[model samples]
Every structure is written in structure tokens, then in C-alpha cells.
Target: MVEKRATQRHRVFKGGTITFENSGIACTVRNMSEGGAAIDLDTTITLPQSFTLLIERDNFVRSCRTVWRSDRRIGLAFVQ
Candidate 1:
């Protein structure tokens, strides 16, 4: 099955961290837009059903929600 995603994506890479219910892991912001972001986390870090993503990019700290996830990665979207 093909996954259909919104096409308004921005090619921005930023460094950040992720905190889940039980653990906190370091991740990288591979690409991001106003709507969502693609993050690269460790393979062993299991993403929770919902979690907070703390993004410290270019002197801006933004928090978002983990909306979708896979084995070693996750998709985050703005909360508000």
C-alpha cells in the first residue's frame, strides 16, 4: 500500500532531542515544515503512541507531537 502524505514539505535539517514516557533519546531533524517533521532516532528507541519532541533549531525551541512512527524513525507535527 502506498502511503499518502501532504506534499507541502520543506527541506530543512535541524538537530534535536526526543523524550518519551520511559526514556529520552537523541534524534536529528532530517527535514521539516510548518506542518510536520521527519526525525532520525536510534533503532533501539521505541517511539511511544504519543510523545513530545523538543526541537532546538537556530535559537528557536519548539515542541511538537509524535503523530506517526516506524521502526527507527518518527513523524512529528506541530501541536498548536
Candidate 2:
């Protein structure tokens, strides 16, 4: 398979939150890079087109858009 990502992601296990419209859902950061991240949710649910991703341990917060999704996992692209 061809590597299509703009930046390389590092495997990680970090707590994250997907926040939108005054609501937040818990997620697990499975892999991350400067450009984007892959996250896993507890259950399959519909998320907004765009949302904020927060990783408290790293003091990270960024606006993200859904790039792809399958089951409980989601691919996100950081929005500038």
C-alpha cells in the first residue's frame, strides 16, 4: 500500500476528547502526527463534520475535520 499521509504518525495511546456544540465524547488517540491523528471511540456514533480535538496530557487542542471513519475508529485532518 502507498503511504498517503502528509506526515508520519507515531503510535501512541493517549486520552482525547472530541468536543462540539457544548458536548464532548471520550476517545483514544491511536496514532498521531503534526498534521493529523487517528482516534478510537467507545461506540459507533455520528459526529459533526468538524470538531475540536483535545489531548490534555500534551496540552494539545486543534480543530479537526473527519477524513474517514469505520466502526469505532475515525481519521482526522487538522484544520488550519
Candidate 3:
């Protein structure tokens, strides 16, 4: 399949936590790009059509929005 993303992805997997409106959960970032990310969650978590993702990396913190979701994963994109 052809990929149609403008940003290049980093293969580094990072450990992180996800706080949803309904619940707070621990998740792992599968990969990341300048534009978005794919997250792996322990269990199925229903994500709103749009939500905020607070990502903390050492001294840096970033926020993104949920664009898509599945049974055990979610896709987030950077908010302009």
C-alpha cells in the first residue's frame, strides 16, 4: 500500500500515558511523525471524533488531536 503522509516518521517507540474524557489509560506510542502518531493501548478505548492528546517527552510537551481510532489503537494529528 502507498503511504500518503507529508511528514517523515521516527521508528522510536516511546512510553506515554493517555488521558481520555471518560478515563485515563497507559499507552505506548508506536511511531511518530511531525504531523501525527499511532498509539497502542492496553484495551479498547473509544475515542471521540476529536480529542486532545497531551504528549510529554522529557522536558518537552506537545498536544495533538485525535483523527481516527480503532479497536485498540488511535491516530492523532498535530493541531494547527
Using all chains and alpha carbons, the TM-scores for the candidates as numbered come to 0.66, 0.96, 0.74
Q: Cα deviation of 36 in candidate 2 (Å)?
A: 0.3
Clashing pairs in 2: none
In terms of TM-score, the best-performing candidate is 2
lDDT of 2 by residue, 41-73 (tens): 999999989999999999999999999998999
Question: Model 1 over residues 1-80: C-alpha lDDT tens digits?
Answer: 77555656677667777766666678888877777788887665655555667665565445577777777777887666
Stretches off by above 4 angstroms in model 2 are none
Give the lDDT of residue 27 in candidate 3.
78
The alpha-carbon deviation from the true structure for residue 36 of candidate 1, after best TM-score superposition, in angstroms, is 1.2
lDDT of 3 at 43: 89
For each candidate, the alpha-carbon lDDT, in order, equals 0.70, 0.96, 0.72
- The alpha-carbon lDDT assigned to residue 50 of candidate 2 equals 91
lDDT, model 2: 0.96
lDDT tens digits, residue span 3-67, model 3: 87788778757777766576656778887888988888898866655555555774433566776
Q: State model 3's lDDT.
A: 0.72
Regions of candidate 3 where Cα sits further than 4 Å from its true position: 55-57
